[model samples]
Target chain A: MDAITVAFAALYQFGDAFAFLVLSACGLAVIFGMMGVINLAHGEFIMCGAYVTVSGANAGLPLPLAILLGALVSAAVGALVERLVVRHLYERPLDTIVATWGLSLIATQGTLIVLGSTMGGIGTPLGSFQIGGYSYSVYRLVLFVMAIAVLAGLYALFNWTRFGVMARATIQVPHMAAALGVDTRSVYSLTFALGAGLAGLTGGLYAPTMTLVPTMGTTFIMEAFVTVVVGGADVFLGTAPAAVILAIVKSAMTSWQGQLFGQIGLLLAVIVVIRVLPKGISGFLLRERT
Target chain B: MSGKFVRGLRAVALTGTVLLGAGSAFAADPIKLGVLEDQSGDFAAATLGKVHAIQIAADEINKAGGIDGRPLELVIYDTQSDNTRYQEFMRRVLQRDKVDAVFAGFSSASREAYRPIVNQFDGLAFYNNQYEGGVCDANMIVTGAVPEQQFSTLIPYMMETYGKKVYTLAADYNFGQISAEWVRNIVKENGGEMVGEEFIPLGVSQFSQSIQNIQKAKPDFVVTLLVGTPQASYYEQAAAANVNLPMASSVNVGQGYEHKRFKPPSLKDMYVTTNYIEEVDTPASKAFVAKFKAAYPDEPYVNQEAENSYLAVYLYKQMVERAKSTKRDDLRAEIAKGDVCMDAPEGKVCLDPKSQHMSHTIYLAKVGADHSITFPKVWEDIKPYWLGEAGCDLTKSDPSEQYTPSNPPSKS
Candidate 1:
């Protein structure tokens, strides 16, 4: 292969990896990083999004509209979960983990019972373009763009909007925010819903490129969790940079060897990052700013 | 008490004893066939049809007055696609229920987990799924096609149809690994070169890197031994990337019915070699499909594994009738004679008595743009020649081992 072709391939691999890590961790950045709730059921929310999106698309809705419907439905479900289950366990962060974990199991098996094990998946839209002899998916590149859009949108929502201000205040100090007439309870619910919606968006976007199984969320869960852990609590400051670093490591390893080594290199990088920076990348960034 | 009362009691007692004796004399014991399959887990969708097929076979035999008036009773257990469950339930069916025989397992891992237990009880068991091959056990009967039957037909045809350069992507488990080995050897033997080979871990959905790698190698065609829901995504991703190279497999559409599950154009131009698919156009196959559909109105596809299991039940009934007994030793002896054959939906399939494996009629099927299947070639009576050549003669001795290309059996 020519050097130009090699460079394009390398760039494509990095972009794919970056998109994957960023999208998988985006929702968790809000729920776990911002809200201080460890949701083991995060994957199920993604599964829900994918299921709804595929069902909608099959029912004759346009693909983009189906994806939007997926995100909305997931947000509604997330809001309901916050009200019924998450509201009771906010003080006991550890208990919230167990509760959400139980919820995940029920949701997964329930989906299996209702929807069966497999569903007809939507075909990936858009065609492919070739660079030299190598061909690449236009849809995958779209995913890369989508990942960037989601991150930038989240940053704007939290930093620039009125709802974002109240949500942040509530997360930082629930009692103070409530005293200040912020309706802390409502903020909490909306924040959780936002997190879940982002997760659903992740699912809907990749639904076409994957086989729609009840357990398909697991494919994203590991990478999602790892990225979240390495990114730390700050979604804006940590998530984007962490994804870039990890993506670079993963793509380089994948290019040098294969996926197995790439995965090994990813986990090894996580361990090293955690050891050197205990609170994560965002924590380090926050410390540097101080 | 009056004399009339005493006479009445004695008569009643006599009638009761006679009725009990008549019941014992006329009605025979039901022959229990243990069925353990993945009915609710990862493989539930793919293997549920097999469980239903077994039911259909058993019901047909019972409807026909069974074997010499002994009803065929199914002792069914849903293993839930878990290996530990296979162990737990295999023991339950064998030791507790004392089932006459068993037709069980979907994956090779589950089979390996419980096959030893079946042997421990000296029970007759049939593993009815296409696998990596080279399992030679006296107490076991494998009705599924092996690498010898699958790859022998698939690799040469793929090479001739596509080109000399091949790329292989397989699941990391034994089935995929061994199958890939067969692909490599067969490709070389056919005077073709394997440009690249990669083993993908189970549950991985992303394939951009793998696709890019395949493109880099520029193989004329690809061989995918991918298993499970996640690996099935490779087709969709590859298609979207415009990798127009044709693909061939021994698994894929035959077992999982991927063509029916995935959208059109994803699986287009893919070829698979198998003993049965729902699309196989034969009177017997059509009848079987009709029966299966009638039994399960909502079932999407009647897969190859289901057909294997369905035929296995009938094969067992034939064995019992020939031996005139359901005893393990009697059936084993009858099987050793090597004349066991069943006219199944996939045409005539015979158990190779020497190796205790099946000889299947392999069909080469292609997926169209609309996801419809068409048979382009057929190889009849393809025997499990590899095991027999590797000295796996159950008639002479019981090896009770699975041999691979890396681990050949020691010639005695």
Candidate 2:
């Protein structure tokens, strides 16, 4: 067996996986936790966000501006979906899942008709930053920062604002909250939109780091699902931290074993976590829910 | 010969995100090549190898002042290894980016889906991965060896080198079935016997049935064409079962599916045919591998999908330079000339003038225990074994079996 390089390289890979995990998990949980919808189409929304960025750049828009346009477009799309499709599905989780899944399939197929069966890249429009030997793509670091900031902002939205308080009450006890004069329906719509907006933000953020594709979101979604599930779907806020831990663990696993064994081992870990901590580590975060 | 199909690809994409600014072709602007591949799906590992090929090609072209003094810009998107998404991503490149040309995908299903799309768009498509052949069209050049190219050489080689009996397993899709028919035909033609021919669905698990059958049949060589995550599970189960295959080969086995999923003994010593095996010698290939290794310091080279995309970018640059124009049709016409030489590790890229399908040299090799291949003949220019007359007339049977392998063994 080769001598495992348990050095700084391990830390770098761990950091990368950690960044990806935290962002995607937080993104998904924000949608699922606040919205209470499985939102299978969440991944497609991410891809759409990537396309929006690419399209804007193709139109000669500045990189930062193009990405902004992408996020705005993605948010608009999410908001529209919420207003149109998701709003109606309030109070129904399973229905939302099936409906969103259908939307995902249609959107993917629609993208196929639009993009053709090929992949493309957005030039590394941003600069880079080197930490030791690992020259991390500058955009990736920026995205990581943005993800953390967004998580904090979203935290503020929940803990520090009246909207957050109402949203929390609605999620915790809709019947009682409604009896107490909370407008649960609007809250559902607002939360779903916010979740989608986050997904769009992820797409926009990931665009520069990744090659744009319609199905790219699926890969992110799979990991995000594991993270959201393992993080505690109930705590809703536990999504990012849980996702980060799992991502780092997976990254470490891949660095130790090749990505092949790493993936299998991580998958096994996810299954085990799901089995043991069914609601995820977030269950620990939420004393009220537990 | 025809422009109808190519036009349809444009129609689908042109409807929405079409790049309307009709900027005249200028040397100042980079000659863009859209590289559509699956970066993060079941095929990600397999497709990852092509990225180096793409980057190296881009650098080489740019070093040479690109097409008519313009630098070549490579735009890549992940298909997530999904055919439907592959089509969508391709459309964005052509209609929106309006790239000079496009190189895309690692699977035959994706190629098939993109065929009509490419036809309608009338833009160049470098379909770089090996797959089952048959559907030929304009604006699309199938770079990887077709069924005829791969199966004809491997079947005869297997029968002559190994015993005459053969066992075949392939995914039950357009790519697999078409290639499977050709394999069966090649064996019959070669005077060898085929013991069994099995077709598994794309994601079907529970390979005990197929594994047991192959063992019971006791074929001299077991040829496989399965791909994706399911393949990993199949290999693991087969390894666990301890069913040592007589001798096996595949056009689709090097996709990194077997690397992390299966153990050492599994699929070892298996002979395989590919346009690329990492061991092929070349400075360009070396640079590509080096850069890729640098990029993903901890990860092993992914596979052909990335390499093909790399080749696609270079091929586009070569064609555009030869044509001295990036006005779509002119480059497509030059590619149609089919005589472009690629500075490739797998020798020269032999383009088919009529179909624009570049028939490059294929490598014949055997896999080692550590999931690496040792290519004996890294560059072998096997003639166009397009299975011309041997191809079952699709008009006869929708799911036809008109194939006749050269070495006809008694299938169990």
Best by TM-score: 1
Instruction: Give fnat for candidate 2.
Output: 0.00
Model no. 1, DockQ: 0.60
Whole-model lDDT, model 2? 0.64
> Which has the greatest DockQ?
1
| lDDT for position A245 in model 1 | 87
Per-residue lDDT of candidate 2, residues B51-102 (tens digit): 5567665666666555667766766666667788777777778887888677
* Model 2 lDDT at residue A134: 32
Which residue pairs come into collision in candidate 1?
none
My TM-score estimates for the predictions, one after another, are 0.93, 0.55
Q: Model 1 chain B, TM?
A: 0.93
Q: Candidate 1: which docking quality band?
A: medium
lDDT of 1 by residue, B221-271 (tens): 999999888889999999999998899999999988899888899998899
Error of 1 at A260 (Å): 1.7
Worst 10 residues of 2 chain A by lDDT: A1-10
